[model samples]
Target: MNFNLLHEIVLGFMVVLLLVAVAVIIERFIYYSYIERSRKRLLGLLAKGDEQAVLKETKGSSCPHARLIGGMLALKGLEKDAFESKVQALYLTQQAGVKRLLWMVDTTITLSPLLGLLGTILGIIDTFNALASQGVSDPQAVSQGIGTALFATAAGIGIAVVCLVFHNYFSERVERINEQLKVMALDQAGAVAGEGSGVRGGREPARIQPQAAAA
Candidate 1:
C-alpha cells in the first residue's frame, strides 16, 4: 500500500471529523440562541406577574426553560419534597433536548488525535519502506518523507483542539442554563408560596429577575 495514500486517507478522516464538530457547534449555537430569546420573553412575562400570560406562553412555547418553569408553576404550593422531586424529574426529561448534538463534538475530540497518530505511523512506515527499496543516497528525500508524514499528526491535533474548545464552551453554557432553570423554578415556587400564605410582613417575593439569569 502506498504510504502517501494512507496518509491522505487519515487526513481525509480528520477533515470529516472536523466538519462534524463544526456542524455541531453551529447547530448548538443556533439552538441556544433560540433558547435565550425564548427565555427573555418568558422572563418578561414572569416579571409582570400575570399568571394567565405566563401560563399561556409556557403552554405554547417549546423552550425547556419555559416548560420547566411552567411545570414548577403548575405544581406550586405542593409540599417541598414532592415539589422538588417533580421538578427534578422534569429537568431530567428535558435534558435530552438541551444536550443534543454535543456527543458528536465529544466524539470528534476523542478521535482526532488518535487518527492523526495513525496517519503519522503509516507515513513513517512508508518512508522506511522506501529506504529499504532504494539506497538512501538522497538524505533530503528521507527528510521530506518524514516531514510529510508528520502533517497527519499535526492535522489531528488541530482538529482535536478546535473541538475541545467548542465542546467545553457548549458544556459550560449547558451547565449555566441548567442551573438557571433550577434556580428560577425554585424562586418562582417560593414566590407562589409567599403569595398563597399571605405572609408578606417578613420576606419579600423572590421572583427571579430575568436579567439575573442571563447566561
Candidate 2:
C-alpha cells in the first residue's frame, strides 16, 4: 500500500482517533482496577466484623462503592428505615459516579464509523475527480483513487469496532459492581437490624415492641 494512499484514506484524523481510543482503554483499566481493589478491602473489613473501621478507612479512599458502604455503616445505630434511606442515597451517588464518562464512550463508538464513512466518501470523490480530469485514460490513477477510498472506510470501521468492544466490556463491569453494591447494602441492613434486636452476643435490651405485640 502506498503511504500517500494510507494517509488519504485516514484523512489525517485517524491518528487522533486511535490516541483517544487508547486513552479510553487505559482510563477504564485504571478506574476498574481501583474500584475492584477498594471493594475487596472493604468486604474484607466487613467480614472481619470491623464495620466502623471499614467506614473510617473508606471515608478517606474516595471510592464510590466504598463511600456507599461507609454511608450504610455510619447508620448502624439508626432505625432500619433510616439506615436503608441513607444507604440508598449513597448508592445512588456512587452509581452516578460509576456512570460518569459512559456517554462519552458511547459517543466515541458512534462517531468513529461515521468519520470513517466520511473519509471514504471524500476519498472516492477525489479519485473520481482525478479520473475525470485525466480523461479516464490511466488505469493506475483510477486504481489509486479506489484504494484510497476503500482504505478510509476500513480504518473507520476498525476504530468503531474497537470502541464498541471497550464500551461493552466497561458497561458489564459497571453493572457487576452495581449488583454487588446492592447486595452489600441489603446485608448491612440485615446486620444492623439483627444487632438492634438482641439477636447478637450483646446483651443490650430490645426496644419496646409494638402495641399489637402486647395484646
Candidate 3:
C-alpha cells in the first residue's frame, strides 16, 4: 500500500476539519454577541406592548433570541396558551439553527483517530513487508518505518482532541442560549398575561357600576 498518498489525504482532511471548526466558532461568537445585545431591551419592549419599537429594533438581526422576541411581540394581546404555542414553534426553529454545522464537528472528531489508526497499521505492515523482501539492508529503514507509524498515531489523536474540545464548547454554548431564549419567551408571555388580567379586573368594577345604575 502507498502510505504517502494515504497520509497526505488524511492530513488534508484534518486541515479541512480545522477550518470548519474555526468557522463554527466565529459564527457562534457573532451570533451570541447579537443575541446578548438585544435581549434585555427587546424583552422590555415586549412587556410594554411596544410592538413597533420591537419590530424596528429587531428587523435586521439574525440571532435566534431576536426571533423569540418577535414571536412574543407578534402575540402581544394573546392569551397565555396561544402565546406559548407560537413561542414554542419559533423556539424549535432557533434550536435547529443553533445546531447547524455541529454534525461536521462530531464527524471529524470520530473519523480522525480511526484514520490515524489505519495509517499506523499500514505503516507498520509496509515496513515489515519491506524487511521481508529486502533482508533489512539498512538500519535507517527500521527507524523511518517506526517514525511513520508514530506520526500517524499522533496525528489521529491530536485531531480527535482538538475537535472534541471545540465541539463541546460550541454545543454547550448553544444549549445555554436556547435555555435563555426559552426563559425570556415565557417571562414576556407571563407579563402579557398579567397585563390582560389587570385590564379585565379594572373593567369589572365599571361593568357592575353601570348595571347598578340601570337597576
Candidate 4:
C-alpha cells in the first residue's frame, strides 16, 4: 500500500469525524438550552389551560418538548384512554426528533479508534519498509513513518475520548428530557380529564405549578 496516501486518508477522516462530533455537541447544547429555558413556563401554561399562552410560548420553537406539549394541548377534551394514547404517539415522535444526529456522534466514537489503529499499523509498515531499503542509513524515512504512526494514533484516541464524553452527556440529556415530557403529558392529561369528570386515577389530577425560567 502507498503509506503516504493511506496516512493522509486516515488523518483526513479523523479530522472529519472530530469536526462532526464537535458540531453535534454544539447543536445539542443549543437545543437543550432552549428546551430547559421553556420547560417550566410551557408546563405552567398547560396547567392553567391557557392554550393561547402556551401557543405563544411555543411559537417558532423547534424543541421536541415544546412541540410535544403543544400537541398535547391541542388534544384536550379527549377521553382518558384516547388522550393517553395520542399523547404516547406524540411522545414517540418527539423522542425520535430529540435523537436526531446522535447516531453520527456514536459513529465517531466507534470509528475513531479503529482509524487510529489503522494509521499506527500503516506507520509501522512504512518504518520497516524504510529500514529494509536503506539499512538505517536514511534516518529521516524511519522517523517520518514513526511520526505518522504516533500522530494518527494520538489523534484517533483524542477524538474518541472527546466524543465519548459528549455522547454520554447527550444521552443523559435525552433521558432527562424524556422524563420531563412524560411528566408534562401525565399532568396535562390528568388536568384535562379532571375537568371533565372531576377526578383522575381516583384523585384530583396533579397540577403543574408555575415557575420562573432559569437565569
What order do you get sorting by TM-score, best first? 4, 1, 2, 3
Pairs of residues at least 3 apart in sequence or in different chains that clash in candidate 4: none
lDDT of 2: 0.68
Residue range 1-215, candidate 1, lDDT tens digits: 78879888888988988887888899899999999999888877777677777778889577998888777777777776676567667767677888888999999988999999999999999999999999798999999999988988898888888888998999998987887676666556565543553111123444444344333
Better of 1 and 2 by lDDT: 1
Model 2 RMSD in angstroms: 7.8
Top candidate when judged by lDDT against the true structure? 1
Cα deviation of 156 in candidate 2 (Å)?
1.0
Give a tens-digit lDDT track for model 3, residues 1-215: 67656766766776776687668667766766677777766656655656577677668677777776665566667665665566666667787777777888788788878878877777777677777888868979788887977787788789789878978988788777867765655455554444443111011111112222120
How big is the positional error of residue 39 in model 1, measured in Å on the Cα after superposition?
Answer: 1.2
RMSD of model 4 against the true structure: 5.9
Q: Write the per-residue lDDT of candidate 4 for residues 1-215, one digit (tens) a residue.
A: 67867878888988988988899889989988878888866656655656667777767777776787677667778777777677777777787777789999999989998999898888788778767777988778678769868888888888889899999999999888877776665555665543642212232444332221100
Query: In model 2, how large is the Cα lDDT of residue 137?
Result: 89
TM-score of each prediction: 0.81, 0.79, 0.78, 0.84
List lDDT for all candidates, in order: 0.78, 0.68, 0.67, 0.74
- C-alpha lDDT (0 to 100) for residue 211 of candidate 2: 28
Residue-pair clashes per candidate? 0, 0, 0, 0
Q: Where does model 3 exceed 4 Å of error?
A: 40-50, 77-80, 191-215
